[model samples]
Target: MVLQGALGVSLTFNCGDTDVAQEAVERSFAIASERGDPLDRLRLLGPMQMLYFRTGRFGTALHYARELAAVAEELGDADAATLARTFKGVSFHLRGDLRSAREELEGALSGRPPKEVASYLGFEHFLAAIFLARTFWLMGDTDLALEQTADVVSSSEESGHPLSHVITLMWAVTVFLWQGDIEAAENHIDRLETRAAAHGLQAYLAVADGFRGEVAVRRGDAAGGAQRIRAALKELHAARYELLTTPLNVTLAEALCAIGHHAEALEEVRAAINLVETNGDLVYMPDLLRTRGRIEAAMGPRKRDTAEATIHEAVTLSRRQ
Candidate 1:
């Protein structure tokens, strides 16, 4: 029962159902607390920490991760320990402590727990690879990012893991967009959208649209890209995953700026910054900061120096891993 509830929470969380995820987490925690099973506790801890992290509750997530690590040790479960360390690493990343994040993630990967079972081992590999890919992408090692993504893709296919494939597809899109490979990004988006629709994974569909919007904006198709982004944001909002609204807003801001709506673009960027600050999730704030800087640069010379400095900070922080 406890395991079921934990898995349910994770599923709902991934699908952008925050309220359902919260309820599931609460039930899982209650069950684990009553059962006094260390692994169960760790299981519940993982999604709970992820929820907190996604909502910009980094300090709370960090606290829970530490507690989870201690419990994993008591339970003598190396796998759970590694998972807890991954959360800690993510928390560090959110806090802009990239060096610590890299160190901890490296340690977790180095201490790779042997694959003991076939049923869920594929997920383990995919999760670890995705986490590493994200960290390396942030660190500006695009080659390593692609390599890690390739690992996830291969393992996901070999294991027939649909969810893992979806996640990897998103990661690949982000990397391609960052590398300025519009054609590759579009190809990946098309593939992801087709798969997502066939599987009824609306959240994945929304993410795909968001990525398409990003690529469109980069290609100077302001109207087309903004339309896609607006649709994506509407879907995510309906699903109650406001946690990532910043990215959508930034995408909109870019489109707006391209279309000569400078004042509106500035407003959108400000909203994104406000959302990031409120959520305390600095992991992607650099992107928002950079966007705002660009918007400001177009306004006048008075903002040019400030804009350049902001972009410099973004590049520096993003490469810190």
Candidate 2:
């Protein structure tokens, strides 16, 4: 019963039903840990790690990941151990520790054959490679980043899991968008929406809408894109889905600036960076800071000093990572 309840809580939390999920998370964890077997304890730990990671609690997420790793090792479960390593890699990526993130993610994908990864990385073939691609891109390895991204898309399409395919495209669109390849990103966004709608994954469909707005912004429809992105952002946050908000905000800020809303754009980026810092999740900081600097620079000579400072900071941080 306790195990079932914990599972229920995790599902609720993962599904964006945060009102009840938040209140029940710790209590469910407590009960399961005290009365459940080690395997059952392991069950809750995986979801708990995912929960914290989703909520941008990278430090706490890493802590849970460590616990999960220890328990998985105790059980002699190689697959679970691999999963922990993947999450640790993702957490490190989010924390802006690119070298460490690269180490763990590569380690997770290193030893296993391609056939084993589908099961090893979980049926959805989540985020390890997806995040790794971004890490490489941020580290200024565009060729390798694009290469890894293509590999991810190919592997995901062949994963035999529809949800996995959707997740891959959902996250992979960023690379093309970052490369200023709106056409490619739009193609993936179309696929993302189709898959999301087919699977009734409403949250992802919502995310798809935001991505479309991003495409629009890139194509010069600043005002319309800003409005569309804002609506989607409202919907996602209402659903307690935060993973893509940072990037979308960066796009939204750019859109706002193009349309002569520099002050609003600055405010938006500031709030976004503050949230990133407060959460100890630096995954999006360099980009957000760069966007902030761009906004200030566009405001003309009055903000030049601060704009230079902001850009300098962003460059330093981006290089460090």
Query: Taking the tens digit of each residue's C-alpha lDDT, what string does model 1 give over 104-130?
Result: 777666743435522222344455566
Give the range where candidate 1 is weakest over 10 consecutive residues by summed lDDT. Answer: 113-122
Instruction: Specify the poorest-scoring 10-residue window by lDDT in model 2.
Output: 117-126
Model 1 clash pairs are none
lDDT score, candidate 2:
0.80
Off by over 4 Å in 1: 3-7, 10-17, 53-59, 111-114, 117-124, 242-244, 305-309, 312-321
- Per-residue error for 155 in candidate 2, Å, reads 1.8
TM-score of each: 0.86, 0.91
RMSD of each: 2.9, 2.5
- Count backbone overlaps in model 1: 0
* lDDT scores in order: 0.73, 0.80
